[model samples]
Target: MYLYYSFIRVFKYLCRERERRGQTMYLRSAARGFLAFLLLVSALHGYHDWTVTYTSSTVCALRGSTVEVSCSYEYPDKLQNRSTPVETLWFTKEDHSQPGGLVSDTDYAGRVERSCEEHSCSLSSCSGNCTLRIRDLRQSDSAEYKVRFITNQPGGEYTGDPGVKLTVTDLKVKVPHWIRLWKYLECQSMCVLSDHPNYVWYKNGQHAEREITKMFYIKEGDSVSCAVEGSERFHSPLVCAKGIKNLCNKVTYSTRTMCVLQGTSVDISCTYSTYRGLKLKEKYWYAWSNNNEPTDLQKDSEYKGRVQYPVKERGGSTLKITDLRDTDSAEYRFKYKSKSHEWKSALHGTTLTVTGLRVEGAAVAPVTEGQRVTLSCSTRCLLPGQTSYIWYHNKGPVAEPESTMNKLVLDPVGLQHAGSYSCSVRGYPHQSPEETLTVSCIMCILCRD
Candidate 1:
């Protein structure tokens, strides 16, 4: 008989075999049989002496984001004493007897990571604490995963049962009927996430602050959208009231123009605001060419590894470029996309000028006491504009008469003037490395001789 049928027969027999005088003997016998069956089944499955636990049996995550699943495992003292775990991994299939059965299958290549803490066999707690992290989640990536390990001892392999189950979902915004003009709009997902993450609201397409209650009030001709916090890419479709969509569009650069030295790094910053209901499809930097349309600099071979777009705040982003060259001088602009595209290139952009910087006077030289010396700071090109220079003596600001002067003069140099000196361009963050100046007291030296 099939194992399932045999269990059914045993259950039926237990039900029919009533003890005389309605005593509890039948119940006791049934309980003992069930316990014995469980033990037999476990032994048959090679799980007789091991225990595994999952922090959460189920996990729900948004598409295009990342998630983590946590787990732990333990084994018998006899196995611990005789063997040591050499390889630990996670898989979605029990046929690990074959290759390519890992949970990080071809479909999830380069997107899955597993981390575990190594533990000695003699430890009383779990032998391993493992966590699985997956990035750029997709609908097809959802599945149940199991933890497995191989030991150094001969024929020592184990797989944990009842592993974690994962589900990926997309976000959506729920709007009420237009009849109620001032009702609340809801940001929802197809299924509830593991921990019920906070929701964020957007109007016209730009991200607003997080909504504590996952609700936004509706107004006439207003288009509102919503997304889960930290998973903005998986936002829901826009829900508009009064059958009209409001267009919210604005972009402004922190400074219209800036100048920097070649071989240095510079940051171009900007703040933007967009309509609530529109979704941002793309964001990038571009520069105008000679009589041609602007070209995206990100794809240019020149900026392959020298450009960075740091994480943006709610309404701002920064572009940082290093190892700048004269050729890098151009008009730089930030552009973003939405479902309802708006092209306003003329209103938002920054002009950058790259020039070489250097100190004009001798950095290090011996000077006689009572002699006068002059140190001047200069740049290679002054077409863009002349920048005021700030001089420092011994790592501190220069004296009042020499302050804010590109050319610093020290008359009647004394022993006290024998120290380090440096200069920097005003409004620039970097300063030249300090140069040492040696002043000699010939009279004192002659006396010592």
Candidate 2:
């Protein structure tokens, strides 16, 4: 490849020289070109000792997606009984003169990945194939890529003369015509580099599914589009044909309300659906209070290390919250995304109410008639304004007006108040566990006896 490029450069220079002068200048330029070609051929012959062959000399990838450059290398074997260690690297620069040739540009710091598998390894030497995968590609990432390997043996470092060329392009939804007879709309990428990328399909601005093909049933008045799976972050613009509006599928939640004991964990569950061909790209939990915009709980400092969302089937997901607190009580919702959709929350959200359970008074108390007794039920934090307190006696509601308050008062203790007592906030599914209350009868002796 380098020889071809060099030849082009030399030919261009010779043509320019010919256009400038007569046969004398033309002859001189032709000689120089011949010398350059000879030098290139000599260099190529020497580099044949350690040759590398790439799967493809050029790759065209979509921006914001991933691309893999693969290559296999061949090298001469070292002396028998001597072991040599081998290291492989992929880079865009040819700076093997320095100790470090794999020094990547800052733009690709964490996005570049390399993997190697040794096809043959013996006491004398080793040979293998290497693949370089780059994620989140950008337009600026288009460049020439090379593979090089170093060995402990003397003069064992070799870099391929010509590298693979990458061309990064943005995705566009091309809709030439709808197949009315087939009842499907053919949506295609302007250009796709990967052979078998998962396609993210969208309709009217909402996600549909991870489509197996770039074709969909046309909905009258609905806009449709498609994008590469990982490139959903940089989705293609929506393309509509007949109608501008139509139904779009979305995610859904299981329950709208939940109550949990403080210090315990709770699972907030939901089931979601999207277009049949679209794939889920990401999912997370977010919360909002008092009409505020929802905030991602994963990024929230308070929820750090205490929150987890377990992976479920394509249609199901769950968020588990540990060490619940009163402050953690809020309207929580599940959010998910496919390649073409941004963060989307469920239409119905789940509300969480974390409460502490405690009985203020003793469970067993011996009291005589005419003695005042009091039993209180309270939570760690004041309940919401609409929350109501309900007192219970022996598993039944206490028929007292003041039972709504935190304290339940028996102005004059009697046997009727001797049964088990407990309290719970109205609207809460559970009440405090029952506590026993014992009452003693008062007796008087007659002096005449």
Across 41-127, the per-residue lDDT of candidate 2 in tens digits comes to 878755575778999988988775678999998776654456656788777754456423343455564456788886575553456
lDDT of 2: 0.68
Best candidate (score: TM-score)? 1
Tell me the lDDT of model 1 at 367. Answer: 78
TM-score of each: 0.45, 0.40
What tens digits encode model 1's per-residue C-alpha lDDT throughout 1-449?
37757887877666666543465777787878877987787676554456667898888898867888887776544444454655778877555474344543656644577888885566432366788888767798788877776665444666667788888888776654434445556666666787677887776455665874444455554556667767554566555555434434545577655667877888898876565645677777777554866555677788879888885666677889999988889888777877776533433267787876455554355777888887766654332334467777788986752343356777878888878877877666677777777898979878899
Predict model 1's lDDT versus the native.
Answer: 0.68
Model 2, stretches more than 4 Å misplaced? 1-48, 95-103, 117-125, 152-154, 177-186, 196-200, 205-221, 228-235, 241-449
Worst 10 residues of 2 by lDDT: 243-252
